[model samples]
Every structure is written in C-alpha cells, then in structure tokens.
Target: MSFKNDALAYHSEGRPGKIEVTLSKPCHTQQDLSYAYTPGVAEPCREIAKDPAAAAAYTAKSNLVAVITDGTAVLGLGNIGPLASKPVMEGKGVLFKRFADVDVFDLELATTDADAFIRTVEALEPTFGGINLEDIAAPDCFYIENELKKRLNIPVFHDDQHGTAVISGAALLNACEIQGKSVSDIQVVFSGAGSAAVSCARHYIRLGVTPENILMCDSKGLIYKGRADISGTYKEEFAQSTQARSLADALQGADLFAGLSTGGIVSGDMVRTMNERPIIFAMANPDPEITYEEACAAAPDCIMATGRSDYPNQVNNVLGFPFIFRGALDVGASAINEEMKVAATMALADLAKTGDVPEMVLNAYGCSSMKFGRDYIIPKPLDPRVLVEESYYVARAAVDSGVATRTIDDWDAYRRSLEDLAEGIQ
Candidate 1:
C-alpha cells in the first residue's frame, strides 16, 4: 500500500487527467449522423427553446451535476490553483459516475472573488440538474451555497460541508450509541473549524445536542466568546461556550473529539484526556489529525475515525455525495435541506447496525468481523446501504418537506429508483 510517483506518471503522461468527455450516443453511419447532429438535433433544441422545462427530457440537463470549485480548498493541498485542482475535480466527476451514476462535469472558476463565484455558478444553473460546489474555502463556501441556493432552481450543495456532515453525522450517531451516549447528553469538541467541522457540529446541534455543550476549535484554540481572531459567519453562527486557548484545554472531559483539521493536529494526549469511551473522528483527508492506531493506543476506551481508505471506518464523502445527490435530483428538489441530511445520517446509522458486515467493508485493514465497537462503529464507504437507506430517507424527507417535485406512491418503488441510479454508477 505504499504510494509512489509511478501511480501518477501515466495520469500525467496521458491526456491531462483521468476522464475523457466523449459522446454518450453514436453517430458513425450517415443515417445515424442525420439523427445525431445538425438537422436532427435542431428539433429538440427548438422544443427546448419553446419550453424550458422540456430541456430536462430532450437534453442531458436532468442527469448532469456541475462540480464547481474556486481552487481555494483543493483537497489536502489547499489553494493549489485552478490548473492544479483539475485532477481532484476530474477524480470527483469520476466518482460521481462510478459510484452514484451522476454525470458530473468539473468547472473551475478563475477568480476567487465571492461575487464572481456566485454570479458564475448562477449563470451555469440552466445546464445542470444539480450544482455540487466542491473544495471552496469556508466563509466563501458559506456565501456560495447560500447565494446559489437562492438564485438557482435546482439543488446547490457544497459537498465538503453537507456531504461531510451527513457521513460524519451517521458515524457519530453510531459512535455515540456504542459509547452509551445520546445526542442530548454529550459534550462534543471539533478540532479544526473548516467545512467539515462546521457541518459536523451543526448536524450534532440539529440532532438535539446542545449548542452550549458542543465546543469547536481552530488552530489557535477553541472558537469562543473571547476569540477575536476568527471573525466569520460560520464561527459566529455556531459559537461555543468553551473558551480554552488550546486543543487540550477544550478536550478536558469532552465526550467526542471530531478532528477536521490537518494531520497530527490532535495528539494522543487529546484523545486520552477526553471522557471514558470517547468518540474521535480525526477526519482530515489523505491523513487525519491523528491515526486510528495512535488514538486507540492513547485511549483504549475511545472510538476512533479518520478520513482514510486503507483503514477501518473510512469517513469519506463517497458514502454520502452520490446517494444524497441522487435523492435530491430524483425528486427534482430545489435545495438540500438540513432535515434531509439529518434523515440521511439517521438512516445510515441504522443501516450500519443491521445484519452482518460485507468484505468490501472490511477492506485492507484486517479483522474478520467488522462489528459496531471502538474500531468499527461506522460502515465503510463502499457499504451498499449508503445509497439504499440514505436516499430513501432523503426522498421521503423531500416529499414531507414539500420540496420534492417527483412523487412516489409506493415506498418500494422509490427505493428502486435510488438503487437504479446506483446500478448506473457501477
């Protein structure tokens, strides 16, 4: 499992990145060409022009999700520029196709200006069924989602924020249950105040965890009353009572340690300092704030999680994005509401608890039985129920909330629609 430059050499040597945006249908023969281009395509275009809603059926608008990024927060690299972020976005598009059956095209806006980002995304609204704003930095990310949701008629989801929230929330629900703690009775502390941190903290809050008990921390320390350093809408929206100057200061007797910051940010001491059977989610991608082994070594009673694939409980957005998007688009929904995310999280948690585990869930990190315990409280990213359960919950929530345009008379058929989407992804 050791990574080398050779893994990337072919990718660099080939045509730019991983994907090739070729035609989906054929036009090799003249008769086929007659229907596929020029005169034949004009009728649908004309119909679409006459009736804008008809574009959904006549063109690819209904199946497409736009992956827009400002190159401000490109994976772990961070602000690597539009050119550099292309690989990651292309990879994301590939994931959307391979995992969720959503056709995604990457859009890297040249400017980092918030208004420009807003205007740009708003302008492209007509082309896609949904807009997935990825890897844009916070405060700006907050603005972009808010504006796009307001302006666009389709779903505008900031995946780094909401997808991370839904998946992490699902894991934490199971983690809290394993630790014999409920959402109403826990003191949660998130390490690193990024998109993931805010989303996790907010999900906990929406799930009935008290805002006062949930302490969120950034680089300099906990984001609290006296912290004048961090001044943004995200921080201000979910300010905590714990005014500690360090991670250790915030972790004393804390029930949960959610890390969404850089690698090695949360030390072993931080995990050990928390309450008995503490739940830890060091969810920084590529590497986490702390490794799974390091956390377990420090506190045997702790339930640990990291944003990694080669380990147990890989809390990747892969578990959430596809199904979440599928549910939203299937219903022709306008926005990804928090209630839908909460329902998806709850569904995921419940799904992980049922039946025996799959080998795909086991992954490279061994241990034959993947039970709901310290090491394996959450389901793996590849767990099939992610789409099956979460999207069901989402579709139902969409209908109940009066946001969904598509209606399903039978619950089983709704479930089938979600599964069908997953089938296409594979």
Candidate 2:
C-alpha cells in the first residue's frame, strides 16, 4: 500500500493525527482556573519582572521547545508545503515529549521568506524556552538561525545542521578509532553542501579537522578553495582546495565520504578510489548516496552507514536533538556552540562501545551489537542511550563550560533523571 493511503487509513482509524493537548497542571475547578488564568498568573509575572531567570523555575518555558519547519525540505518528499508537513512535525513533537520530556509545539511556518521566517520566530521566541529549526533548506536556514540568535536570548538550534553533525561526528570518531586513522590526517569528502553538509564540515573542523583535508561537493561538483565550481551563499563559506568534477574525483584517495547529498550520488565504481577501509556515510533519507551493499563490495573493509533504518549504522538526528537541547537549556545556554556538539559526539561514540541496548534497537540496524569492529562503529537511532546516558554528558559539558543556568551536580543522577523523563514523557 502507498504511504499516503496507509497514513490516511491509520489516522482515520485512530484519529489519524495528533490528539488533544493535555494540561501539565491540574485545572479541575473554578479556583484552579482563577489561579491558572487571572489572579494566580500575575504573581509569577511580577516575579519574572523582578528577576528574568525566575521564568525558568515557574513556567514551562525551560522545558518547551518550538519545533519550527517550513516544509521546504520535509524529508525525502521535499517542498511538500507547510500543511503537508504537519504529520512529520507532530511526530517530531511527540519525540521531544517522549525522549527528553520536553513540551514541543510543532510549528509549520506559514511563510517561506527568509526575513519573514526570522521575524516570525523572533516574535514567538518569548514563549518558547528554545527554538528547534527543523528541515528548513539551505541558505535560508543559515539566515534564519543567525538572525534569531541575534534577536532572542534563548538558545536557537537548527537540528538538521547540528544534529546531523553531532551524530555523524560521533560515528566518524569511532570509525577512525577502529580503522587506526585520525580526522586531522585524513581528507574528508562531503556530498551535498546544504545545511547539513556545511554545518557538518564546520563542526568537524571545530573537532580538529584541518581546512586542507576537507573537500565539499554539490550536484555541480566540488567546492574547491579557489575553484568556482559551485556557487551560492551557502557553498561559499567552506570553499576549499581542489575542484572535484565528480564523486569519483572527490573519492580519489579520500579517507572519508560523508553524504548529505542525494541517493545514488556515489556508486560502487567511485568507492574503489578511496583509501583502504574507507569510511562512507551515505546519509540520504530513504536510500543513500551509495548503497551499503555496493560500498561493501567495492571496499571489503569499508565501514558504511546511511539515514535509512535498514542499515548497519543509521545516523539519525533523534539520537542527538532531545538531550542536546536538554543540556543546553538546563544551563540557560546562550547558544548551541561547537564544543557542546563535540561533547555530544564523544558521548554518542562511547555508547556505541557498551553493546547493551534494547533488542529492537539492534534489529533495526541489521545486528544486535557491534563490538568495536567494522560494522558497529556507530549507534542506532533508537539505541535508548540517546536520551539516557548521553544527556548527562551534554549537561555536564554545559556545566563545565559555564553555559548551564541550572546545574545538576551529579551526572549519574542526572542521567537517571533523563531516563525517567523519557519513560513518562516519550
């Protein structure tokens, strides 16, 4: 059956979409309404006026995240428009609640203009604890995030960018560890220089990737340092060393191929050009830049991954987002900086080592556990540790960095608390 038909049938059968919003606080009587609404609300407002930070203690703002998307880049079906992106947005909202006990209001932006997007989010910022920009396409995503951060004091994070970076970086760290390579010593080739690619490059560099070793490619070709192969405000930022006419050239002796591009962008023939045991993350949704089977056959020792569920290492952003924002907001983070992401990556990489997640998590990735080997260098999307142990690392990183407004002294206790939150909220 078709996905649309199945979704409609399922939703029709079971209310098909999201249900009614439940109150966090009780509102059983008239007195409750008076307190929740008219008279009781004023006291908290007055206190917030006296000390702005008090808002976190008294209101849901600290735990609330605005899941904003424009439907411009909604999954594999790109540019489906805002209304159509509702189900996906709502699903994201459910995840926030489930994984991190975060209260999210999924917002399908009415307009697509960069300036309008910025203004709209800025206007809404006062209501949310943090803003999670989801699936908005390139250059515009860049503009919106930069503008919103400038205007709002709350942490503004674009999940597609940072989330992808964090998970991918973690996977890369482990892959390199197993392969006996280092990011600084290798040449990294990235396919698709959109929001995901650029941010990944930026963050990877922040984690010790040298500028000379990174190469970017779009549909047109490689983003060489002086080469005018690709253009656009987005591509210009990380423009580097050599002009890559194709993925084959990009893979020529390249140590890594990080795909944020399209499915089938890289082929079996291209995989042969990489260094031995080349690490390839063909992370295009639904499929990938290169299929794992093909990459494996081409380079027998290759460690492969994708954005799909039926893969060895699925680099899903859900593994990063919930806890990432949890940690950032816990400390009243001013911004979602690169260091926090690196810390997140490190934690995720460690989780891959434990080999002790739910059975379903292993089943989803075609295996139960990958014990420090070629196939198990990354974590699965639903590996549980994402909202479990990882949040503690992120929260601790925030506290250490002094970005956390509300600090939790014990990481082990905090990690358990997150697991509890996930149990109730998710």
Candidate 3:
C-alpha cells in the first residue's frame, strides 16, 4: 500500500484518532463510582477550594499539559486550519505519553486572532501544569507566547521555537568540539528568519556565538541593517550591518550554516564557500535546504545534520520537549525559563560525550555502535538516557533558578522515578 493509505488506515483502524483518555483509577464497582464522582470526589474539591495549590496533590493537574494550537502552520503543511490539524495534535499527545509518561489534552482553537488565542489559553491555566503552544505561525506566535507566558503561572513553551533551539544548540556544542572551533569566534549564517530560525540565532548567542558574527536571510534576501522589508517583524532583531546581501553571499567564509527555510535553496557551491570543517544543519522538514548526500559531496569534512530521521545527527525536537516538560512538571516549575533551557542543552551535549549508548538504542536504530563524533553530535530521541539526564538537569536548574514551587528533597529518588517512566516505555 502507498504511504498515505497506510497512514490513513493506521489512524482509522482501531480508532478514528491517535489519542484517548484512559482512567488512572479504577471505577468498576458501585462504591468506586461513588468515590470517583459525587461524594468522595467532593473531598478533594473542598481541599482544593480551601487551598488552590492543593489541586496538584488532589488532582491530575500536575501531570497534565495542554498541546494547544491554532493550526496556522501544521508541520510542512501550512495554514491547514484547526480541524485539519487534529491528527498532528493527537500524534503529539501520543509522543508525550509514550516518551515521558506525561498526559496531554490536545486543544485546537478555531480562531486566528492572537489576542483571542492568548485569552483562551490563559483561561485554561487551572486545568494544566504546562502549556505547549504548537504549529502557530510566527510574529503572531511570538506575541501569543509572550502574552501567555506573562499571564500564566505555569510553564508555557512554544516547541517550534525553543525545541529546535535547544536540540540544535546541543548539536552545535558537540560539532564545535569536533571541529576544534570556538562558538564565539565562528561565523554563522541562517537561511530562514521565521520563529525557529530567529529563535535558534538567539539560542546560539546564548551558547556563545557572537551576535555580530551572525547573518540571517529570509525569502527576500539577507536581513541587513536598514533593511526596509523587516521593519516591525521578529527579523529586525537579527538584522546585521554587513555588505553580504544574499544567502550565497552570507555563506562565504562562514563556519556554520543553519537552514530552516524551504528545500533545495542551498547548493553544493554554497557549502564549498564555507570555511573548513563547516557545520551545516539544513533542517527543513520532508526536504532540507541541502540533502545529506549533497552536503557531504560538497564539503567532505563538514559536520551535517537535518530534520530527517534517516541521517545521523538528526535535530529532532522529540529529544528535548518530552524530557524538558517532564522535569518542569515534576518540579511544579512556574516557568520554562532560560536557565532550564540551557540546562537541557548542556545535559544533551554531555550525554552525547559519555559514549554510553545503550544496546536498546542501537537496536532501535539498527546500528551496532554509536559514539560522540562528527556524525553522532546529539543524543538520539530513542536513547532513553535523555529522559533521566535532561530531566534531572532541568529540574535542578528550575530549583536553582528559584522558579520551582515544589522541591525534590532526595535527588536519587527523583531520578529513579524518571527512570521508571523511561523503563515503562522501553
């Protein structure tokens, strides 16, 4: 059968969708039903009413995240609307459950107005431990997320922006080591100026890439100083004062190329124009700006990564979000702040260097061995170790950063609990 038919059949075979709510407590008996409903349930309600923080203890709110979207940018399929984006949202729920044992309720809002979306999500804070905003288009995405973060106490994360930043930041750390280059000294070029690309440029700066040394380009051309086209957009933050005015012009002597634009926009000649051992992440979905085969053919020594699974060093966001949220939720974090994000990136980079790829991870990917190198720059999404490593670091950072409402007294026990969650899936 064709791939599309197989996917449709898979989603439709047992159920019409990819996710469902399962009971955490049994209600088989009449007595159990009473406890689950009216009288017994009222006890927890009374306690929560008396102390609003008691909701975390008496309900599932501590473990629940709402995967909310307006569907303006559903994967590579742009602006498909809310109803058409249900499958992707449900699939996101599946990943949250399967990977970190986190419960997700996918909410697709039918409105495109940023204020309306923010208001709706802000009103939902009582129901969720975190808000994961997904697939919303940029500029508006930037506004919505900022407003939501300011208004909501719980962690509000836009996976499209920071997820790519965190994962790629880890890969950049490792790639810099292998190439013997300093991030602060490297010349970086970006092929897209949307949410992910702009966020990545910001994150790489936090990871030590100099802001002035970076060049960013959107669909028009290079985002240079005094570029009239990007006056009020998020791209304004990245506008540089440079003579380089095109993607190819930006690539000359560049040490790193990060592409979040459409496919086939980068060429072999562009790769050759970069400095020796250039690190390239052509991360457009379905197709990259430059294919892995073509990238290697252009610069044999270049460290390459993409958004595809078939290649080594795939910068999959799954490696970050599941574990990052697990940690944030575990600690009752008030926000997914910059400290926690930096901690997650450091954990992933450190994990790759440990060279302790589990046998199961290798078997899952049909490989005999894996280690930190030019090819293995980031931890695989299936490596299981990421759950404990990244989560632990993020939790620790949350507590240290003074954003956590709850604290873990015993670190070892907390790690074991995370390990149990990982083991459950494996």
The 0-to-1 C-alpha lDDT of every candidate, in the order given, reads: 0.81, 0.82, 0.94
lDDT of 2 by residue, 1-426 (tens): 899888778767765676346788989999999999998999999999999889898888888899999999988888998999988888888777667777888888888898988888888976888899988877788888988888888888999899999999988888988888887898899988888998899888887788778888887777766655445466777676565666688789999999987888787888998998799999988879888889999999988988877666778888888888887777777667666788899888888887567676657656645566776776665666667667777777777777667767676776677777656653
| Higher-lDDT candidate of 1 and 3 | 3
Using all chains and alpha carbons, the TM-scores for the candidates as numbered come to: 0.93, 0.92, 0.99
Off by over 4 Å in 2: 1-3, 229-232, 358-370, 410-412, 422-426
Per-residue alpha-carbon lDDT of model 3 for 342-401, expressed as tens digits?
999999999999967999989999999998898899999998889999999999999999
Q: Candidate 1 lDDT, tens digit per residue, 1-426? A: 235677687577767678877787887999889889877999998998898878767888878999888899988888988878988888899888777777889998899899988988888888899998988998788877888888888988888988888888888888888788977889888888887788777887887788888787777777787567666456866565554767888888989888888888777877778898888888877788888889899988778777887676778888888878878877778778877888888888888788887665555346577876666766776666577787788878888998787677899987887777655543
Best by TM-score: 3
By lDDT, who's the top model here?
3
lDDT of 1 at 221: 72
Total clashes in model 2, counting residue pairs 3 or more apart in sequence or in different chains = 8
Q: How close is candidate 3 to the true structure, as a TM-score?
A: 0.99
Pairs that collide, model 1: none
Specify the poorest-scoring 10-residue window by lDDT in model 1.
Answer: 358-367
